[model samples]
Target: MRLALATAVVLSLFTSPTMAEPTVKLHAAGSLKAAMSDIADLYEKTHGVTVARAFGPSGLLRERIEGGEAAEVYASANMKHPTTLATAGKAGPVALFARNRLCALAQADLAVETETLLATLLDPQVRVGTSTPKADPAGDYAFQVFDKAEAFSSGATEALKAKAFQLTGGKDSAKAPEGRNPYGWVMESDKADLFLTYCTNAVLAQRDVPELKIVALPEALSVGANYGLTVVNDAPQAAWQLAVFILSPAGQEILASYGFTAAGAL
Candidate 1:
């Protein structure tokens, strides 16, 4: 009877379901998708923990976190969003993980260069595209470029802002077909002649549309972007570990390969 009872107990133990592995939820900017996905894969392989990732506009992600969405870590295109969360006690201290810069993605026929970027953008017939400001940091950076343009040519800022189309990264923005780059799709669809976005994004867009031209912003109108990262308050230790890995040399190397200026280099 004792032997039979012992066998039954062992059998039940073998049939019982094991506890689920720990998961870290990460909310990050859309621009970080490719690099972050790679980083997550490496971390999961090394630490044996699952990383659930969600990517979109940084500002929108911040709003979601603010509205009580569950996120272990938040990565933003600008420090302002994560810093705001830290200020509100929703997240931990903000840290700079990566850096980027603004560039112009222009249609093939448009004759634009760094020197003539301002004139090309301000041209009455040209249709300029930008991300939605306040909903996406890309738009804020584009507008910052416009602000710098004001110094070179009076009213340049107003002219550029008024004519720019808020195409992507907005609540009502048109959705790109699956497997399509949003910026490339928008430009290819004749939505805009020129679009201002992050240099990394512009590179991706160019990859999507081989003929598309990426024009560097002139020195006078240049805008540098700083990406911030933070873990939500009370998150598991694994979340902090993930954040640390993102700032580590291995992760920075991955980001740099994607055209981002790593935090260490920045």
Candidate 2:
């Protein structure tokens, strides 16, 4: 009896009563930073699972995943990247998680409004800033705006595309100073007189630089963004749970507070 009890104690010492919770690895678009941080915190508190997150341009993040980086979940600023992953069998089905629209961030003294927004962007004297196309969805959306400009005037697309400065979202783009919004920092540094970016990003930029103005794109030029979420193939169960929670009402509320149109609402 004494020998048996000692053996039992040894086995107990090597085994845990409950399995350790898994950590979920999430790669998401930079635009989702503020919202996803809150969601991750809430998920940790409620589910007892830690989340490791990486944020950047959605297209770049997708490229990292395609290149064999270990990401259990992916959230993108547009459906294209995540859908591409899903098509490649790298991830599960894509889901629309959020929506956003474009707006122009202008210098405090710049004269811009919905009525003259196109003219302002076309003016030879104005310096237009944009994210790098194909590497960032914001830049793609800006170009889409330029495409729509063609309906108003011929040769508008080429002219706007030629003058636009690709200042951010590329691999070598300058990093903003610590604790500074990239958009605000760029404007403060006089990188451009009018920068086209997501409306939500514009809001954050304005918060950082109160003097900056956020001008809404005219109805004719407005372009909407669709955010996508997916669970990577072979990801642990915790990843699926986290993805579900992001689509949950509670998660949607957090995103909505940050100016995103929640998936359910759309």
Best by lDDT: 2
Those runs of model 2 whose alpha carbons end farther than 4 Å from true positions after fitting are 1-20
Best by TM-score: 2
| Candidate 1: tens digits of C-alpha lDDT, residues 147-183 | 8988988999899999999999987889999999999
Cα deviation in Å at residue 247, candidate 2?
Answer: 0.2
- lDDT of the candidates, in the order given: 0.88, 0.88
Candidate 1 accuracy as lDDT: 0.88
Per-residue CA lDDT of candidate 2, range 1-266, in tens? 22332243344335433343468899999989989999999998999999999999988999999999999889999999998998898877788889999999999999998899999989999999999899999999999999999999899999999999999998989989989999999999999999999999999999999999999998889999999888787776667677878887888999999999987832
Prediction 2 TM-score vs. true: 0.92
TM-score of each predicted structure versus truth: 0.91, 0.92
